[model samples]
Target: GEEVAQTPKHLVRGEGQKAKLYCAPIKGHSYVFWYQQVLKNEFKFLISFQNENVFDETGMPKERFSAKCLPNSPCSLEIQATKLEDSAVYFCASSHELPNQPQHFGDGTRLSIL
Candidate 1:
């Protein structure tokens, strides 16, 4: 498919709940991007991967937040023991490693933590 496929448009979890979001990047695209958005503001890049390996994770939270890109599987961002501050729209973009390929994005998963 040409577009990134994200599942469950909206998710609600209570404090200390475990919330998992899924993103299937455009097929054959080797690079995937992840970000967290709050109040329609700037995107904060969380992590990115090429194929199944981590390329950069400097922006990712040190704890309670985890993500994975696995072979033959959709990429995922899982929030463990979610906090009220964890609420946000998590977006993922994908493209080839080349400099000019336009990145494709998924309609972010809105995670609401109460």
Candidate 2:
């Protein structure tokens, strides 16, 4: 069956270190997105991709965050030089398209910076 998968439900990192999260979108889905939820509140859009091409990434932090959708592999988001404020739930979602299709979210990768 089709489902979004995320591993390492929880992660702890020291300040100035790096954190990497993974996501596997449902099969046949063409659009993938990444979001960050701080304190389990509002979701902040980080990036979106159509197939292997990035559609939009304006919401992503320029300095330390990077993401990619690779063929035959689950999508990944990497954070460099983690900070206290970077602690949050990182969710991966996938949809057929952005206009009408609803995105399915994974349980999320809970990141804690200490």
Candidate 3:
């Protein structure tokens, strides 16, 4: 079976500081996705990558967030200049891009900006 794992189930950071989250997607999956769920609301797509190349990042905030998908290494999402509104659960998912292939998600890294 395949799985996605994320570290630091919860994180607290002050405004203007930085927070980094990590994720390990299932092996053999080429597409990695990152999403944010704010206040238990909708899951907003932040970015997606295919084999280290960004496939879509139109939904990502241009100011404070960035992500990377690397081979063998766990994917990472880093937020700089954190703001209170930046708090949310950051989820990492992976899929094979095949029909009926659902994306597998991690428990997520909950971030709190104060």
Candidate 4:
């Protein structure tokens, strides 16, 4: 099956350090989303991008979290000055439609703040 690819399955960083995660959405998908999972089965939408422009980022933390999706390149999510609360698994999902459409998620990158 075609799948989204996430790099560095696990990452560790000290408090106040920075963490960057990469996601390669499945080919042909036109929309990409970023999520943060803090508790099991609990996911918080962080941001989303349609092609190279951001679609929705209402859930993003204005200060420390940033994401970008550029043509012909993998999408990226970055966390600056990471805090203990930032420890979570970041997942990227892709879809062809905005709503009522099936989305595929990447393996997820687990970030641990120490």
TM-score of 2: 0.96
**Model 1 C-alpha lDDT per residue in residues 1-114, reported as the tens digit of each score:** 789988779999999999999999998899999989987887899999999999899999999888999998999999999999989999999997767888889999999999
What lDDT score goes with residue 54 in model 3? 93
Best by lDDT: 4
Candidate scoring better on TM-score of 2 and 3: 2
RMSD of 3: 1.4
Error of 4 at 78 (Å): 0.4
The digit string of per-residue lDDT tens for model 4 on 27-77 reads: 888899999999989999999999999999999998999999999999999
**Runs off by more than 4 Å, candidate 2:** none
Using Cα atoms with residue i matched to residue i, what is each candidate's TM-score against the true structure? 0.95, 0.96, 0.93, 0.96
Estimate, for each residue in 25-47, the C-alpha lDDT of model 2 and write its tens digit. Answer: 99888999999999667999999
What C-alpha lDDT values do all the predictions have?
0.91, 0.92, 0.89, 0.93
lDDT value, residue 78 of candidate 2 = 96
Clashing pairs in 4: none
Q: Quick one: how many clashes does candidate 2 have?
A: 0
Better of 1 and 3 by lDDT: 1
RMSD of 4: 1.2
Cα displacement (angstroms), candidate 1, residue 74, comes to 0.4
lDDT of 3 by residue, 1-114 (tens): 368889989999999999999988888888889999996778999999987889899999998889988777888999999999999999999998755789999899999988
